[model samples]
Structure formats: structure tokens, C-alpha cells
Target chain A: EPEVTQTPSHQVTQMGQEVILRCVPISNHLYFYWYRQILGQKVEFLVSFYNNEISEKSEIFDDQFSVERPDGSNFTLKIRSTKLEDSAMYFCASSKPTGGNTEAFFGQGTRLTVV
Target chain B: AQSVSQHNHHVILSEAASLELGCNYSYGGTVNLFWYVQYPGQHLQLLLKYFSGDPLVKGIKGFEAEFIKSKFSFNLRKPSVQWSDTAEYFCAVNPPNAGKSTFGDGTTLTVKP
Candidate 1:
């Protein structure tokens, strides 16, 4: 089965440095999303993208965070300056809606570590 | 704000034991409910979903969930579980038109052989 794929299974970055997480969603999927899970915490929604633009974002997705569909197959999340609290597992997901029912498929997730 | 609540944080069971995981959501509008499972070192995989249909829905691996609209609950159940069923389970809720989902804290299930 086709699945969403994320690059760099693990990444360690210095504080105040920039990091980019990439994802390639399923070819036919129309909606994409980014979610994060802090250690021992719930999975939090970051942003949702459709039609090459962000549809909705959460408070956690602040000014430092940005998402782009740089190409037809690539979706990326960029953080301008990483912080210690930014360490978490970031997941990329995609879904195709049918009659108002949308079931998202999640990627293996990229573990981001900020020091 | 919409939120999902999973009552159990961790559960231990023996093989062939019946299992039930409690999930409740706080959303006034029409919502879609889903259950996802994550095995060790694996991505989150969809186990089942409840949109608009019968209250009782069956999913993969002989698992089922009942969507009780009056109670705002969608509890997952299985008649018998195996050691392979050990994993983390999450419940999520989203509005019909919106793609954003709110997930629960997740429940860690360990099945002993």
C-alpha cells in the first residue's frame, strides 16, 4: 500500500539553528497535515495544507514555523530557530476525502532533537 | 475546543483476554471519530473510523467500536486479543468539514503470552 514518506528518520540540531523536515505524501492525496508529539504527550496538530496553501494552523504553529509544497510531490516544514522545547517527533500525514469522510495516513515520523 | 479523552493510560492483559479501551470526545458539532494503532517503531496506522452509519462499526483484526452519540463516546472493543495486539492506541476526533484532528493522550496496551 502507498504511504506517506518522511526524510531523515532522526535529526539533531543546535539551538537557534534552522531545520527542515521533508515529506512526500501519497501521489493521489489532496490534503496534507503536520503533527507533533512531545515525549509522553499527546499528538498535537500543527497545520493542514490543501491546494498548495495552509488551510488551518494551531497555536503551536507560531511565527517560526512554515510549511511549503515546494513541488508536486514534496511537502516541507521549516523552523527558523529551534529551541530545546522543540524536541519532539514530527509526523506527516495525507488523506483523500470521500463524501466528507477523511481518514488520514501517517508517516513513520521524524525525530527532531534540539540541543 | 474539541478534544479527545482516553481513560486508560496503560493496560496489561493476558492472551485470549477480552479488551476494551474507553474513548470520549468533547465536540458539539458533527464529528468524525477514528482509532489508530502504533506498533513498536512503526507509524500510526488507522484501525477504524466512524463517520455516518450504524452505531457499531467493525474494523481490522476483529476489533470493533461503538459510537454512542448521546454519550459522546466511541469505545473500542475486541472479543479476544493476542500478544501481537500489544501497541499504543489513540483516539481522534475532527469536524466533518475540517481536516484538523485532535488526538487523545494514547493508551499503552501490553498483552502477555
Candidate 2:
């Protein structure tokens, strides 16, 4: 089965540094999403992208965060300046909105650690 | 706002024991429900989903869930679980046309051998 693929299984960056997490969504998927899970916390939605633009975002997705569909299959999340609290597992997901079957397929996730 | 609630935070069971995890959501409109599992040091994987068919939906690994629309509940169950079933299970909900999914805090299942 086709699945979403994320690059750099783990990343460690210093505080105030920039980091880019990359993902390759399923080829036929029309919606892409970025979610994060802090240790021992629930999975939180960060943003959703469709038609090459962000369709929705959460309050946690402030000015520091940005998402881009840079190419046909590549979707990326960039943090301008990472904070210590930004350390978490970042997951990318994609789904095709076929009626009520908008079930997303998640990537293996990129573990981001800010020191 | 949409939200998911997982009643059990942690549960411990022995091999071959029956398992049930409760999930509820607060949404007023048409919604799609899903259950996902994350093994140790792994990413989330879909366990099952309820879209528009029958209320009872069976997923991989002998897992299943029933969607109770009136009560806003989608609870997962397994007839007999094994040690490999130990993982964190999450319940999620999304609107029919929306791309974002709101997830519950998750229930950690520890199946001892």
C-alpha cells in the first residue's frame, strides 16, 4: 500500500535555529496535513494543505511555522526559530477526499528535538 | 469545535483477554471516525475507520469498532489480545469534508504475556 514518507527520521537542532521537515505524500492524495505530538500528549493538528495552499491551521501554528507544497509530491514544514518546547514528533499525512473516506495515511514521523 | 475523548488512559490485560477501549467525540455534524495505533517508537497506523456503512467495522489484527451515532461513541474491541497488541491507541474524528483530524489523548494498552 502507498504511504506517506517523511525525511530525516530524527533531527536535533539548537534553540533559535531553523529546521525544515520534509514529506512526500501519496501521489493521488489531494489533502496534506502536518501534526505533532509532544511526549505523552495527544496528537495535535498543525496545518492542512489543499490545492497547494493551506486550508486550515491551529492556534499552535503561529508565526514561527509555515508549510509548503513545493512540488507535486513534496510537502514541507519549516520552523523559522525552534524553541525548546518545539521538541516533538512531527507527522505528515495525506488523504484523498473521496466522499466519506477521507481517512489519512500517516508517515513514520520525524522526531525533532530542540536543545 | 470538535474534540475526541478517550475514557481509559491506561489499561493492563493478560494474553487471550478480551479488550475494550471507550471513545467519544463532541461533534454536531456529520463526522468520520477512526482508530489508530502506535507501537513503541513507531508512527501512527490506522486500525479501523467508520465512514458511511454499517455501524460495526472490523480492522486489521482482529480489531473492530462500533460507531454509535446517537451517543457519539466509537469504541474499539478485541476478542482476545496478545502481547503484540500492547500499544497506544488513539481515537480521531473529522468532518466529512475537512482534512484536519482531532485526536483523543490516547489509551495505552499493556498486554502482558
Candidate 3:
């Protein structure tokens, strides 16, 4: 089965530095999403992207966070200035449909550590 | 907002033991229920899902779940578990008519040999 792939399995950055997490979703998938899981916490949705634009985002997806589909196969999440609380396991997920009941395939997460 | 409730936080079992993990949701509308497993040092993998049709659903490996609409529950079960079954499991829910989803805090299962 086609799977989503994320680069930089682990990332360490200073509190004020910019960080970009990259994901290459399944080739045929049209809907992409970014989710985060704080250590010992439930997975939380951050943003959902479709057609090269954001369809929905949570309150945690503040001005400092942005997503871009720079190319056909790559989707990236940029954090302009990281905070200590930004450290978490970031997961990339994709689905062929954005409909309510469609199944999503999740990639192994990228662990981000902000110091 | 929809949310999932996993009653068990952690469970420990010996090889060949039977397993049952409880899961419930707080959505009044139709829901798409899912059970995902993340083995130690591995990515999340789908164990089972309930979209429609018969309440009883079978999935990968020896896992199964029964979606009880009236109870708003979708609990995962396996007749026998191996050490390989030791993993963190999450119960997730999404309204059948919506795009967003909510997941429960994971339950860590320890299977001893």
C-alpha cells in the first residue's frame, strides 16, 4: 500500500528558530493533514490542506504556523518561531477523499524537540 | 466537538491471554469508528474500523470490534494475544458526515512472554 513519508525523523531547534516539517503523501491522495501528539497526550489536529490551500485549522495552528504544498507531491509545515511547548511528535496523514467517513493512512511521526 | 473515551489506560497480559479494550464516543450523530495500534518504536497502524452495515467488524490480524450505535461504543477484542500484540492502542472517532476526527488518549498494552 502507498504510504505517507516524513523527512527528518527527529528535529532539534532553538525556541526562536524556524522549522519546517516535510511530508510526501501517497501519490494519489488529495487530502493531507498535520497532527501533533504531545508526550503522554492524545493526538490533536493542527491543520488540514486540500487543493493547495488550508481547509481547516485548530486554535493551536496560530499565525506562526503555515502549510504549503510547494509541489505536486510535497506538503510542508513551517513554524516561524518555535516555543518550548511546540515540542511534540508530529504526524502526517493523507486520504484520497476529504469526506467524513474516508479512511486515512498515517505516517510514522517526526519527533520535534524545541529547546 | 466529538471525542472518544477509552476506559483502559494500560493493560498487562500474558501470552495466549484474551483481550478486550473498551471504547466509547460522545457523538449523537452517525460516526466512523477506528482502532489504531502503534507498536513500540513503530508507526501507527489501523487495526479496525466501523463505517456502516453489520455492527460486528473484523479487521487485520485477529482483532475485531462491535459497533453498538445505542451504546455509542466500539470496543476492540481478540480471542488470544501474542507478545507481538504489545502496543499502544488508540480509539478514534469522526462524525460520519464530517472531515475532522478526535482520538482518545492511548492505552498501553504489555504482553509478557
C-alpha RMSD over true interface residues, each candidate? 1.6, 1.0, 2.5
Tens digit of lDDT per residue, candidate 1, span B16-112? 9999999999998889999999887666888999999898999999999999999999999999999999999999998876667899999999999
Off by over 4 Å in 3: A98-100, B97-99
TM-score of chain A of each: 0.98, 0.98, 0.96
- Angstrom error at residue B53, model 2: 1.6
Over 4 Å off, model 1: none
- Residue-level lDDT of model 3, residues A1-115, one tens digit each, is 6889998899999999999999999998888899998887778999999888999999999999999999898999999999999999999988765455677778898999999
Once fitted onto the true fold, the runs of candidate 2 whose alpha carbons sit more than 4 angstroms away are: none
Q: Which residue pairs does candidate 2 place in steric collision? A: none
Best-fitting candidate, scored by DockQ: 2
Better candidate number, 2 or 3, judged by lDDT: 2
Give the whole-model CA lDDT for all candidates, comma-separated.
0.92, 0.94, 0.89
lDDT of 3 by residue, B1-113 (tens): 78889999999999999999999889878788899998776678889998889999999989999999889999999999999999999999876544456899989999999
For model 1 chain B, where is the 10-residue window of minimal lDDT?
A: B37-46
> Residue A114 of model 1: what lDDT?
99
Q: Recovered native contacts in candidate 3, as a fraction?
A: 0.52
When sorted by lDDT, best at the front, the candidate numbers are 2, 1, 3
Which pairs clash in the backbone of model 3?
none
Preferred candidate (DockQ higher): 1 or 2: 2
Evaluated at residue B75, the lDDT of candidate 3 is 92
Which of the two, 1 or 3, has more DockQ? 1
Query: For every candidate, what share of the true interface contacts is present?
Result: 0.56, 0.72, 0.52
